[model samples]
Target: MVAVDDMNRRILNLLKADGKLTYREIAAKLRRSPSTVRDRIRRMEDYNVILGYAAIVDREITGMKADAIVLADVEDGVSVRDLRKLNGVDGVAEVSAVSGDRRVIIRLRAHDSETLDTIISNKLIPAGLKDVEVRIIMEEIMRFPGTS
Candidate 1:
Protein backbone atom coordinates (compact mmCIF):
# COMPACT_ATOMS: atom_id res chain seq x y z
CA MET A 1 0.00 0.00 0.00
CA VAL A 2 1.09 3.55 -0.67
CA ALA A 3 1.84 5.70 2.35
CA VAL A 4 -0.24 8.85 2.47
CA ASP A 5 0.42 11.97 4.50
CA ASP A 6 -2.24 13.66 6.58
CA MET A 7 -2.96 16.18 3.84
CA ASN A 8 -3.24 13.46 1.20
CA ARG A 9 -5.52 11.45 3.45
CA ARG A 10 -7.73 14.48 3.87
CA ILE A 11 -7.64 15.03 0.10
CA LEU A 12 -8.82 11.48 -0.54
CA ASN A 13 -11.54 11.79 2.09
CA LEU A 14 -12.83 14.86 0.29
CA LEU A 15 -12.79 13.16 -3.11
CA LYS A 16 -14.31 9.81 -2.15
CA ALA A 17 -17.89 10.93 -2.78
CA ASP A 18 -17.10 13.60 -5.34
CA GLY A 19 -14.33 12.67 -7.70
CA LYS A 20 -14.67 15.80 -9.73
CA LEU A 21 -13.44 17.99 -6.90
CA THR A 22 -11.22 20.76 -8.14
CA TYR A 23 -7.72 21.03 -6.72
CA ARG A 24 -8.90 24.25 -5.14
CA GLU A 25 -11.68 22.42 -3.34
CA ILE A 26 -9.35 19.73 -2.01
CA ALA A 27 -6.80 22.35 -0.97
CA ALA A 28 -9.49 24.29 0.86
CA LYS A 29 -10.61 21.13 2.67
CA LEU A 30 -7.04 20.33 3.74
CA ARG A 31 -6.12 23.96 4.41
CA ARG A 32 -3.30 23.75 1.90
CA SER A 33 -2.35 25.65 -1.23
CA PRO A 34 -4.07 24.60 -4.46
CA SER A 35 -0.73 23.92 -6.19
CA THR A 36 0.36 21.66 -3.35
CA VAL A 37 -2.94 19.74 -3.56
CA ARG A 38 -2.58 19.37 -7.32
CA ASP A 39 0.96 18.01 -7.03
CA ARG A 40 -0.07 15.51 -4.36
CA ILE A 41 -3.07 14.38 -6.36
CA ARG A 42 -0.87 13.95 -9.41
CA ARG A 43 1.58 11.83 -7.40
CA MET A 44 -1.30 9.80 -6.02
CA GLU A 45 -2.65 9.13 -9.49
CA ASP A 46 0.74 8.19 -10.87
CA TYR A 47 1.35 5.79 -8.00
CA ASN A 48 -2.14 4.22 -8.22
CA VAL A 49 -3.14 5.63 -4.82
CA ILE A 50 -6.01 7.04 -6.79
CA LEU A 51 -7.40 4.69 -9.36
CA GLY A 52 -9.86 5.91 -11.94
CA TYR A 53 -12.84 7.90 -10.77
CA ALA A 54 -16.43 6.81 -11.32
CA ALA A 55 -19.99 7.68 -10.48
CA ILE A 56 -21.64 5.01 -8.35
CA VAL A 57 -25.17 4.35 -9.48
CA ASP A 58 -27.50 2.63 -7.04
CA ARG A 59 -28.21 -0.82 -8.52
CA GLU A 60 -31.62 -1.28 -6.92
CA ILE A 61 -32.89 2.07 -8.14
CA THR A 62 -31.51 1.39 -11.62
CA GLY A 63 -33.42 -1.89 -12.08
CA MET A 64 -30.78 -4.26 -10.82
CA LYS A 65 -33.85 -5.40 -8.95
CA ALA A 66 -32.52 -8.24 -6.83
CA ASP A 67 -29.36 -9.77 -5.40
CA ALA A 68 -28.34 -12.89 -3.49
CA ILE A 69 -25.36 -14.03 -1.48
CA VAL A 70 -24.63 -17.64 -2.52
CA LEU A 71 -22.37 -19.44 -0.09
CA ALA A 72 -21.07 -22.84 -1.20
CA ASP A 73 -18.41 -25.46 -0.69
CA VAL A 74 -16.67 -26.80 -3.74
CA GLU A 75 -14.53 -29.91 -4.14
CA ASP A 76 -10.75 -29.97 -3.81
CA GLY A 77 -10.11 -30.01 -7.54
CA VAL A 78 -11.96 -26.72 -8.16
CA SER A 79 -10.47 -23.24 -8.21
CA VAL A 80 -11.72 -19.70 -7.42
CA ARG A 81 -11.73 -18.73 -11.11
CA ASP A 82 -13.90 -21.77 -11.87
CA LEU A 83 -16.61 -20.43 -9.57
CA ARG A 84 -16.11 -16.77 -10.48
CA LYS A 85 -17.08 -16.80 -14.14
CA LEU A 86 -20.76 -17.69 -13.89
CA ASN A 87 -23.84 -16.44 -15.67
CA GLY A 88 -25.57 -13.44 -14.02
CA VAL A 89 -22.37 -12.82 -12.06
CA ASP A 90 -22.35 -9.06 -11.73
CA GLY A 91 -18.96 -9.31 -10.08
CA VAL A 92 -17.03 -11.89 -8.15
CA ALA A 93 -16.70 -9.79 -5.02
CA GLU A 94 -14.31 -12.22 -3.35
CA VAL A 95 -13.29 -15.86 -3.57
CA SER A 96 -11.31 -17.30 -0.70
CA ALA A 97 -10.36 -20.89 0.05
CA VAL A 98 -11.72 -22.14 3.36
CA SER A 99 -9.85 -23.86 6.17
CA GLY A 100 -11.85 -26.62 7.89
CA ASP A 101 -14.93 -27.86 6.02
CA ARG A 102 -15.29 -26.43 2.51
CA ARG A 103 -13.07 -25.43 -0.38
CA VAL A 104 -14.10 -21.82 -0.97
CA ILE A 105 -16.55 -19.01 -0.29
CA ILE A 106 -17.83 -17.07 -3.31
CA ARG A 107 -19.76 -13.83 -3.30
CA LEU A 108 -21.77 -13.06 -6.45
CA ARG A 109 -24.73 -10.81 -7.15
CA ALA A 110 -27.26 -10.60 -9.98
CA HIS A 111 -30.50 -8.96 -11.08
CA ASP A 112 -32.69 -11.66 -9.50
CA SER A 113 -32.76 -14.87 -7.46
CA GLU A 114 -33.56 -17.19 -10.35
CA THR A 115 -30.41 -16.09 -12.11
CA LEU A 116 -28.49 -16.44 -8.87
CA ASP A 117 -29.78 -19.99 -8.33
CA THR A 118 -29.01 -21.03 -11.87
CA ILE A 119 -25.44 -19.79 -11.53
CA ILE A 120 -24.93 -21.65 -8.24
CA SER A 121 -26.78 -24.87 -9.13
CA ASN A 122 -25.28 -25.16 -12.57
CA LYS A 123 -21.77 -23.78 -12.32
CA LEU A 124 -20.42 -22.97 -8.86
CA ILE A 125 -21.36 -26.16 -6.99
CA PRO A 126 -20.81 -28.57 -9.85
CA ALA A 127 -17.12 -28.44 -8.88
CA GLY A 128 -18.11 -30.34 -5.69
CA LEU A 129 -20.91 -28.54 -3.98
CA LYS A 130 -20.93 -30.11 -0.50
CA ASP A 131 -23.52 -27.60 0.67
CA VAL A 132 -25.08 -24.26 -0.23
CA GLU A 133 -26.84 -21.32 1.46
CA VAL A 134 -28.53 -18.23 0.09
CA ARG A 135 -29.42 -14.89 1.63
CA ILE A 136 -31.64 -12.32 -0.05
CA ILE A 137 -31.11 -8.86 1.36
CA MET A 138 -34.29 -6.88 2.04
CA GLU A 139 -32.47 -3.61 2.70
CA GLU A 140 -28.93 -2.32 2.66
CA ILE A 141 -28.32 -0.92 6.12
CA MET A 142 -24.73 0.18 5.63
CA ARG A 143 -23.71 2.40 2.76
CA PHE A 144 -21.16 1.55 0.12
CA PRO A 145 -17.37 1.98 0.54
CA GLY A 146 -17.62 4.62 3.21
CA THR A 147 -14.52 6.42 4.60
CA SER A 148 -11.82 4.08 5.74
Candidate 2:
Protein backbone atom coordinates (compact mmCIF):
# COMPACT_ATOMS: atom_id res chain seq x y z
CA MET A 1 0.00 0.00 0.00
CA VAL A 2 1.19 3.49 -0.85
CA ALA A 3 1.69 5.72 2.18
CA VAL A 4 -0.54 8.81 1.97
CA ASP A 5 1.91 11.03 3.81
CA ASP A 6 1.46 14.73 4.51
CA MET A 7 2.49 15.74 1.02
CA ASN A 8 0.13 13.27 -0.60
CA ARG A 9 -2.74 14.47 1.60
CA ARG A 10 -2.09 18.08 0.62
CA ILE A 11 -1.97 17.10 -3.02
CA LEU A 12 -5.31 15.26 -2.63
CA ASN A 13 -6.95 18.25 -0.95
CA LEU A 14 -5.88 20.53 -3.78
CA LEU A 15 -7.13 18.10 -6.40
CA LYS A 16 -10.42 17.66 -4.50
CA ALA A 17 -11.06 21.40 -4.65
CA ASP A 18 -10.25 21.56 -8.38
CA GLY A 19 -9.56 18.37 -10.30
CA LYS A 20 -8.60 20.38 -13.39
CA LEU A 21 -5.41 21.68 -11.73
CA THR A 22 -2.28 20.64 -13.57
CA TYR A 23 0.75 19.12 -11.85
CA ARG A 24 2.59 22.45 -12.20
CA GLU A 25 -0.27 24.29 -10.51
CA ILE A 26 -0.45 21.79 -7.67
CA ALA A 27 3.32 21.86 -7.30
CA ALA A 28 3.28 25.67 -7.03
CA LYS A 29 0.60 25.55 -4.32
CA LEU A 30 2.36 22.83 -2.28
CA ARG A 31 5.89 24.15 -2.88
CA ARG A 32 6.86 20.81 -4.38
CA SER A 33 8.37 20.01 -7.75
CA PRO A 34 5.96 19.24 -10.59
CA SER A 35 7.59 15.85 -11.12
CA THR A 36 7.08 14.95 -7.47
CA VAL A 37 3.40 15.94 -7.60
CA ARG A 38 2.95 14.03 -10.84
CA ASP A 39 4.58 10.90 -9.44
CA ARG A 40 2.43 10.97 -6.30
CA ILE A 41 -0.72 11.39 -8.37
CA ARG A 42 0.25 8.55 -10.67
CA ARG A 43 0.93 6.26 -7.71
CA MET A 44 -2.45 7.10 -6.19
CA GLU A 45 -4.19 6.40 -9.50
CA ASP A 46 -2.46 3.05 -9.87
CA TYR A 47 -3.66 2.03 -6.37
CA ASN A 48 -7.24 3.18 -7.17
CA VAL A 49 -7.12 5.94 -4.59
CA ILE A 50 -8.23 8.38 -7.29
CA LEU A 51 -11.19 6.55 -8.78
CA GLY A 52 -12.04 9.01 -11.57
CA TYR A 53 -12.92 12.61 -12.42
CA ALA A 54 -16.12 14.28 -13.59
CA ALA A 55 -17.65 17.66 -14.40
CA ILE A 56 -19.80 19.36 -11.78
CA VAL A 57 -22.74 20.80 -13.69
CA ASP A 58 -25.36 23.30 -12.62
CA ARG A 59 -28.61 21.43 -11.91
CA GLU A 60 -30.83 24.31 -13.00
CA ILE A 61 -29.07 24.58 -16.34
CA THR A 62 -29.54 20.85 -16.82
CA GLY A 63 -33.33 21.19 -16.24
CA MET A 64 -33.16 19.29 -12.92
CA LYS A 65 -35.19 21.81 -10.93
CA ALA A 66 -36.34 19.44 -8.21
CA ASP A 67 -34.28 17.41 -5.76
CA ALA A 68 -35.46 15.24 -2.90
CA ILE A 69 -34.14 12.79 -0.34
CA VAL A 70 -36.22 9.65 -0.03
CA LEU A 71 -35.95 7.60 3.14
CA ALA A 72 -37.76 4.29 3.25
CA ASP A 73 -37.74 0.75 4.59
CA VAL A 74 -36.75 -2.05 2.30
CA GLU A 75 -39.41 -4.66 1.99
CA ASP A 76 -38.69 -8.07 3.47
CA GLY A 77 -36.64 -10.37 1.22
CA VAL A 78 -35.14 -7.51 -0.82
CA SER A 79 -31.51 -8.35 -1.56
CA VAL A 80 -28.57 -5.96 -1.41
CA ARG A 81 -28.04 -6.55 -5.12
CA ASP A 82 -31.64 -5.51 -5.73
CA LEU A 83 -31.10 -2.35 -3.70
CA ARG A 84 -28.09 -1.50 -5.82
CA LYS A 85 -30.26 -1.74 -8.92
CA LEU A 86 -32.03 1.46 -7.82
CA ASN A 87 -28.94 3.34 -8.92
CA GLY A 88 -29.80 2.45 -12.50
CA VAL A 89 -33.19 4.16 -12.24
CA ASP A 90 -33.50 7.52 -13.98
CA GLY A 91 -33.09 10.54 -11.64
CA VAL A 92 -31.83 8.36 -8.80
CA ALA A 93 -28.57 10.07 -7.97
CA GLU A 94 -27.65 8.08 -4.85
CA VAL A 95 -28.80 4.98 -3.03
CA SER A 96 -27.46 4.14 0.39
CA ALA A 97 -28.20 1.63 3.12
CA VAL A 98 -28.02 2.94 6.64
CA SER A 99 -28.84 1.74 10.12
CA GLY A 100 -32.09 3.35 11.25
CA ASP A 101 -35.84 3.00 11.41
CA ARG A 102 -35.77 3.65 7.69
CA ARG A 103 -32.84 1.70 6.30
CA VAL A 104 -32.75 2.81 2.69
CA ILE A 105 -32.04 6.39 1.61
CA ILE A 106 -32.12 7.71 -1.92
CA ARG A 107 -31.23 11.04 -3.49
CA LEU A 108 -33.46 11.87 -6.42
CA ARG A 109 -33.48 14.67 -8.98
CA ALA A 110 -36.05 15.54 -11.67
CA HIS A 111 -37.40 18.37 -13.80
CA ASP A 112 -40.27 19.19 -11.42
CA SER A 113 -42.23 18.03 -8.41
CA GLU A 114 -44.60 16.05 -10.60
CA THR A 115 -41.74 14.26 -12.26
CA LEU A 116 -40.16 13.54 -8.90
CA ASP A 117 -43.45 12.10 -7.68
CA THR A 118 -43.69 9.94 -10.78
CA ILE A 119 -40.22 8.49 -10.21
CA ILE A 120 -41.06 7.55 -6.63
CA SER A 121 -44.46 6.11 -7.47
CA ASN A 122 -43.76 4.38 -10.74
CA LYS A 123 -40.15 3.43 -10.31
CA LEU A 124 -38.97 3.24 -6.68
CA ILE A 125 -42.13 1.79 -5.11
CA PRO A 126 -42.46 -0.86 -7.80
CA ALA A 127 -38.90 -1.91 -7.07
CA GLY A 128 -39.81 -2.84 -3.43
CA LEU A 129 -39.17 0.29 -1.40
CA LYS A 130 -41.92 0.92 1.15
CA ASP A 131 -42.96 3.30 3.92
CA VAL A 132 -41.41 6.06 1.84
CA GLU A 133 -40.83 9.58 3.12
CA VAL A 134 -39.53 12.25 0.79
CA ARG A 135 -37.94 15.50 1.89
CA ILE A 136 -37.52 18.02 -0.89
CA ILE A 137 -34.28 19.98 -0.92
CA MET A 138 -35.06 23.68 -0.73
CA GLU A 139 -31.59 24.99 -1.56
CA GLU A 140 -28.10 23.61 -1.72
CA ILE A 141 -26.03 25.64 0.73
CA MET A 142 -22.96 23.53 0.06
CA ARG A 143 -22.04 20.62 -2.18
CA PHE A 144 -19.27 18.12 -1.64
CA PRO A 145 -16.48 17.78 -4.17
CA GLY A 146 -16.98 15.41 -7.16
CA THR A 147 -20.79 15.50 -6.97
CA SER A 148 -22.88 17.48 -9.46
Q: How accurate locally, in lDDT, is each candidate?
A: 0.70, 0.90
TM-score of 1: 0.70
Q: What does candidate 1's lDDT look like per residue over 31-80, in tens digits? A: 88999989888899999999878776677776665665656676667665
> Which 10 consecutive residues of model 1 have the lowest summed lDDT?
84-93
TM-score of 2: 0.89
Using lDDT, give the best candidate's number: 2
Give residue 109's error in model 2 in angstroms: 0.8
Question: Per-residue lDDT tens digits of candidate 2, residues 1-148?
Answer: 7898999989888888899999999999999899999999999999988888878889999999999999998788985458776767889988888888998889999999999999999999888889999999999999998567
Q: TM-score for all predictions? A: 0.70, 0.89
Error (Å) of candidate 1 at residue 32 is: 1.6
Where is model 1 more than 4 Å wrong at Cα? 79-105, 126-130, 145-148
lDDT of 1 at 1: 46
Clash pairs for candidate 1: none
